[model samples]
Target chain A: MMIEESFVNGNSLIHRLNPVLKIGFAIIYSFVVAVSSKFPSLFAALFIALFLVILARLNPRKAAVRLAAVNGIIILFWFFLPFTFQGEALFHIGPFAVTRPGVIFAAGITLKANAILIAFIALVATMRVTTLGHALNSMLIPEKLVQFFLLTYRYLFVIQTEYQKLTRAVKVRGFRPGTNLHTYRTYAYLAGMLFVRASVRGERVYQAMLCRGFKGKFYSLHEYSISKADITCAVFMTAAIVILVVLEWTKII
Target chain B: MDKDNLIINLTDISFSYPEGAPLLNNLSMQFYKGDRVGLIGPNGGGKTTLFHIIMGLLKPYSGKIEIFGKPVREEKDFRSVRQRIGLLFQDSDDQLFSPTVLEDVAFGPLNLGKSVDEAKVIARKNLDSLGLSGFEDRITYKLSGGEKRMVSLATVLAMEPEILLLDEPSAGLDENTRASLIKVLTGLDLSYILISHEMEFLDSTTTSVYIMKDGKVFMNGDRQIHRHYHIHPHSALPHRHESGFGKKYTDFLA
Candidate 1:
């Protein structure tokens, strides 16, 4: 299955926080994980991220799949770093010697990546896209950028649907992927036609928007007010992140 | 507010594209409350363009449009009244632009400044009225053609407008769906102007009919309707049949 922004529903504290504050918490969590190199602090951060994941009620198997895919790519850099770094040698692999500093660096990078991903999946992915856009706009994000995000999310399904229809038509004609010129030309033509039709559809959608009293700014019937509970969650999460980073810096950990 | 008892009155409306000849040439008509008017014409005969002109999507060079006894002269003039008069586009894709079915239906009420909860209530009610339930979270791209058309109509009806302007509503519907659509439209209490090429659908829905050509109204109160529809350009006769005012319309045809 394709990895999408699949939001899970739960009544955990993480789910009730304001989306803007959740974004801030994710940023702070990622920063603390990135700057810390101590194994104990990184391990603590990883465990906290996992606990939040469980608290948010996200499926562990689904979360593991994404983490595995990310780690699979990062592991490629480890092979070269261990051989290229000039440090105290630890192990030998045929002609290249693995170094201690390279091993520690790779371990740190892996932990940081996992911690950040877990934090994002727990804190940010729990909200709906429309509410997320509204939260960002309320946080003084430029209207244009907010609209850009909204339109992109809204029309992505439309674009995917159009492409699927085109692909189906081509398949019905017995076309298949190959390295031949005929297949490549047909694919190129299909893409061009889809773009042209999409452009025309875009204009008609705009006219429909105008007919329905659409101004430049998007207006929704629901207005979100930051609740007291949401404020408490945000403040608590921010403080936790700060204390974790300070303890790591002081080596008290 | 409607002292004239006229829901819509357009006097000598004329409009054209910059590169083309007159699309609407001296068009004039009047519609009253409780009037289900059928507007029929050939391809590119200014039917849809007339709807745009009335909705203030397109501005006419020299013409006057009155909606509910108030003159509409500019694009902004239509904002307040636009929500009161729903315009159903020719394409359901254009109308149901929201990602989810519920959101699409809720758009009109939301735009009219209804609370989100109130808009959802109205949307659910309209969808239920159309026999569509448990479809709130369905994405737009996944719906069938008939379902899309029904959802588009649901969005329009959710607004609870005083008048409806429908364009080619029966174009892509199947037999059963079209029948259901006719039944739904027949049961409506509000006035509407239906533009379609399907004469049977129009006859089933409209109380009176207008045949347009060369950007002008052909159906009139006189018998000289043949001058436009046959001999000249789109001159018309209103229901020139035995069921229509007990007159054999063949005599009016040139």
Candidate 2:
């Protein structure tokens, strides 16, 4: 539901593009922002990405909640990077000095990451995985690869369900979380048991597929036909990125 | 009643697991086109195994099985027969694999080589006919058990098979969903074989019944079997009954 909520508000020109085209444009945009070393360029790109995110019509508060949960580890890394990397001392503390370059480098990495994250969230949060797969196939991606992507997305949920069931079963057996090494070992063993159970369930799923005439190909009703509007939107987004990049190169404000 | 148009025929069919535990032994029966037969038995009576064998999903150790008047011996024959016979599995979770309801319902038609648009039309028609409109975009995992079962049946219906094999179609449904399912099942024109423990549903929906005992056909008849078994409205199990058919069937099992 959070994912669904994140897709509710966008009416921007970029949001109107085909999902596949948006994904491609996002990939290109993220790559360009990632390799650039100029602070002004990165800052401009981040601003544009945030603007596009707003255009997507997504609820900023809901998006923030979902992203906060998923990106906790990334935020932790960002927090530690400035302290760990030593550079020219901007100021000295009891044990650590914050260097100017270190700060800039960290800022650059953070900006690049945020840009990539925004693009992905905009594309995936709005489109269902089935729609995304069909759009990719319509763009002439290999059917086998598309099938793999679809299956992986489906099984990810299946695995999560299995894990929940295992945890419940363990709890019913009176297993409680604790701080000792033995408890840690028990958790590891449960994780191993979860993998085994998932594999067995996977085999049963495969058998079910075979029964239903799954001959190494996934079949779905979702279809994507690229229209003139799709092409126009893709071209417009590309043109906007080119103009932005060129203006930056020309040192225009 | 014509014998030549018999859709399914089993003779001396015996099946055992790979470890040599027998599941079905010398079971023989014939199903005519348009027959709505209900299979009933206690647990471990090989009801599901018999259904699997009839669908050609599982092979019997010995005996001859013919579907649509053709013997099933190889994978190609099984595939052809399977396409004509739709099997609605017991677990909706096992049957409905796709992420969305529309995709899961369209899977059978698409596999049978229908184009995307054609499959969509078929899937939509089936879903709508089952009164599951507005569910096309819903995720499969999020659906309730009864809804999942209805969607699973819709998937098979999209294939337009002549024969339908349902395993416990009303196992865990509430009264409302079960009543709706009964209405749908009664309206279907295809020949159907239902495996269920719902005695009331079986009595109301099926014209004939086959009870399995010890992996063999014990009793096959019209509503008379239900009467003789004393499965009446007020009666429970272990009722007194004549022993001719029951004794013979038990002897066949021994």
Candidate 3:
């Protein structure tokens, strides 16, 4: 199964932004929005995030699809939060009272969550994962952790391919999955075999690395330099985040 | 060949897996500077294991490995040996770990202490030599089987090693790709020990053939292993004896 990195490829300005700065912007923007409780700042954050999505040229329908997955868990909050929190009753749903504070709290959470997610999708997700690894490494993340991240990203596809091969072999031999002990055991065996193959492949990969003189350090061919666009992006993101903070703290909507 | 021309010498090599039977038993082999050798063996005959030992990926229980006329024992000793000797793995997936083709090809050159631009230049040159001029930005995992094999070769070639050890370079390749592989292999100026089962491929590419079986290598000389045949009336498909041994081999309906 191919990984669908739909937002990574584009010719938009956001796509051209430096990945290191983009990661930094995403983290700060998300953190700021996460701590704000007022509605004006949250709505502003949502608007900024939407602006970023527009700048990224991402398809609106696709963005909504991604947002829907995140909101699936948030919808559970809507179910219980409106009826349980202590506040002025907004309305009566049969025997339960819907509190005003509960409704407001849930709405604030929804806005904050989506604003952060959308901005992150626009900023961090626009670059390839390998580039992200380099960016993270340049940000002073541990070399081992960056290496682990990059290697995991590279091998996830291989492991998935291995999985499909095993699934095909089992399917060709009249093996049908069902709620039975035989099916469970077959799946268990399949998992076991996949692990065995993966471990063996891992050994061979390490050997191949050593053959090429891999001495505990991975060098990247990518050279990242700050451009005019990166500087503009950094300035814009900082200003937007500062405005959000001021609107929340100083109540200057 | 003179002792001065020896590229790799493995003397008294004996290796076996833990809790398993022996594989290579006192196997002695010598590779010279200007030799294209083909190593053929049955499955589980320790062909891949031998390649690993020569590159110091695996340690032999009892052996003396001499590369470039110098004895190599410890891991540090093998580091220099690995730089001069490249090994193409049996599976291209196992060989390529980078996200893109260019990065993967440049990996060996970069490891060899080349600058980024230098490594990229070498990578592009090798890729162009292999007729893969525009595959630099292509995702490694998304490549076709034949393309992946060629790219894997490009990765090995980018290092500019003195010798290459290719493990089943043509396995699972189509006719056109296999033909291209044969052309590339024959065009190389450096020496290589090609491990393959295809007699036609081995016949066209190697100057000599060695049969490895039962933990020992027997010299097969520069003989014509590729033969033409037709489907027998008694059989359903045209097939030749891959091993070219045993009593049933005479049933090819010549």
**Best prediction by TM-score:** 3
Q: Model 3, B1-254: lDDT tens per residue?
A: 89999998889899999998889999989899999998987878899999999999889999798999999999999999888898999999998999899999999999989999999999999999999999999989889999999999999988888899999998999999999999999999989999987777888899787777778776646344665654446678766656553323223211
Those runs of model 2 whose alpha carbons end farther than 4 Å from true positions after fitting are: A1-16, A67-80, A83-87, A179-197, A225-232, A243-253, B222-254
Model 2 CA RMSD to the hidden true structure, in angstroms: 4.6
- What's the ranking of the predictions by TM-score, best on top? 3, 2, 1
Candidate 1 lDDT, A25-45, residue by residue in tens? 787788888888888788888
Instruction: List the candidates' TM-scores in order.
Output: 0.79, 0.85, 0.94
After TM-score superposition, what is the CA distance of residue A16 in candidate 3 from its true location, in Å? Answer: 1.4
TM-score of chain A of 2: 0.80
Judged by whole-model lDDT over C-alpha atoms, candidate 1 comes out at 0.80
Q: For candidate 3, give the lDDT.
A: 0.89
- Report backbone clashes per prediction: 5, 3, 0
Best by DockQ: 3
lDDT of 2 by residue, B62-150 (tens): 99999888899877778787788888888777787788899888887888888999889998999999999999989887899999999
* Reference-based lDDT, each prediction: 0.80, 0.78, 0.89
Worst 10-residue stretch by lDDT in candidate 3 chain A? A1-10
Better of 1 and 2 by TM-score: 2
TM-score of every candidate's chain A: 0.90, 0.80, 0.95
Tell me the alpha-carbon RMSD of every candidate.
7.3, 4.6, 3.1
Q: Point out the higher-scoring one by lDDT: 1 or 2.
A: 1
